[model samples]
Target: MWEETSAVDKYGASPTGESFEPGRQRQVCTRYKRKGKRHRRQTGGATRTVMALDSLPSRVVLLYDEWLKLADPRTEDWPLMASPIAQTLIVIAYIYFVTTLGPRLMENRKPFDLKNTMVVYNFSIVGFSIYMIYEYLMSGWANGYSYGCDLVDYSSNPLAVRMAWTCWLYYFSKFIEMLDTIFFVLRKKTSQVTFLHVFHHSIMPFTWWFGVKFSAGGMGTFHAMLNCCVHVLMYSYYAVCAMGPAYQKYLWWKKYMTTIQLVQFVMVTVHIGQFIFMKDCPYKFPVLLYIVGLYGLIFLVLFLNFWYHAYTKGKRLPKVAQKSKALQNGNGVHHSNGVAKEATNGIFYGTTNKVANGFHHGNGIHNKEK
Candidate 1:
């Protein structure tokens, strides 16, 4: 049996009977057998050989091509006269114009409500976020950059046009984000539009511009990937809150959101550090180093300040309690529905006096009449 098996090969053809050496015969027979097995698969062609264009939705490819034309930033007829520095300056000027002009124009109007428009807006942001994550996870495993940041290093692995379209959507979303401040101004929520908010909003569009410009396929895809995940949760929370009472408790992890943002910055910094310290890397590091450094410091300061104000200082509000007591006494309890009342303390105080007084009115609230 062993002699027969050795004499025969992957193909039914007897190797010893063939003119070629048994090893060479076996190699050819194995290949022939493999091809025959592949033909049995339900799909016709090898998946890797399939063109992405064949599977891509027609509208997406069209839009992607259009966006490429607009966003390419490469042209001899209209050459890039100014460096990225000029573009950065232009963005700064635009920020200044909006910050100054927007307030005055919107002064009379009420702040924008997160009710109807915010729901749509957040849904869109989160939807794009999901697409970004999907693309990132898919490409990361396949050994390719998800976003256009791949040019920083050449990837032998090919990506689909759909992946390219998804990345373009992520890129354009940065432009649409300018409306975040517009909404803030319309609602007279200018106080919320801090320098951190404006600066972040301003820089990101240009940062992504350069991201696509220099490193059109590389480690930077992780930045978009991470941001998308964060935005998914963040905007979903916003959308839920906008829906009135539907899912108000959905964002129970609001405190942790800031922590996650801080962690993201730390991770980005560390990743950029690797690029800087490494002796051998395929990417150009100087540009990425500047971006990562600037981004890290800015986010660290902004996040720490936000954490302090939102949690730390907020916890130390005995002064607010004292003021509440003062206002309570100053209002003076009144009789209503056969009951009396007394003064109390802060925001967290109870309605004990309301129970005694039967019905009472204070601080824009009406208690039940006894």
Candidate 2:
């Protein structure tokens, strides 16, 4: 017994010769209990965090539902205005094609000869623009519109309904105009697909969706009408270019198109700006007026920049013309190759080449290579 007691003391017995196993076991159990309590607290916190995260999506969906309720009931059943998803998808697909897939596909493929198609397409847009212009004029601008503080006629009046239809048609025309980019891709004129080009094309339809959805006809239609007028001249120019080089004489007014675009934005900005000073204009959606005004201002700045770089800097001249000018100056420096190389650099870099090769402007105008 003494030997066994000695062995126990050597291992874990207290100095008083008492075995420490029971006390040690108690300490170990206490440590485990404390650990278990801490684990429970951590697990509870984790569960709460997970639950909050799970509810986030539900909250977002609820917010979206509330937003949709604010949309115009009249346009709720319209084709693309019913939901934003269709238009969003269309814009996404357009970006993808023009930026990535279209270019890669056309890498090895030859450019399509679309002269005839372009002629028909341009003329069709001209005709459509004419029709829209007439509708806009008769419906409001010419009928009895004050041209300032014109409210949306939501009533079922014949002219109001006609304006609404015209607005929808105008909205739809934005999508149709997207084909301009598609043609560029198909023709392997990918160089014309500048950020401005794609951004303008994509953003127009998306923004117009809301415009037509909320305020179909009113002062909102002013820009649309002006845009159609611009399109009339722009597409007619494109149609003439598609006809052949024999008709080049008709294009002497090409630079004026940019001027006209600048004028259009100026008018839009001034026209939409009227709402700011008006006392009691009951435009159903005053928010849209501000948006259109800002839009006009932004495009006005962009086009002014374009005009400065394109015309003021003498970059709007044709390559052949530029080379001839260089030759005539006795500079003995041939810039045709250099200009060509610079034009391929990027947007706004060698804008002359861009403007020369029928670059599509954001305002739906195309300048064919001279």
Candidate with top TM-score is: 2
Model 1 TM-score, all chains together: 0.56
At residue 193, give the lDDT of candidate 1.
Answer: 55
Each candidate's lDDT (Cα)? 0.53, 0.75
lDDT by residue (103-161, candidate 2, tens digit) is 99999999888889988998999999999999999999999999988888877788888
For each of the candidates, give the backbone clash count.
14, 1
Best by lDDT: 2
Candidate 1 residue-wise lDDT at 24:
79
Candidate 1 Cα outliers beyond 4 Å, as residue runs = 1-97, 110-114, 141-167, 305-314, 317-370
- lDDT tens digits, residue span 212-277, model 1: 554444565556667677777766655665666546445455445557667776666666556656
Can you give the TM-score per candidate against the true fold? Answer: 0.56, 0.77
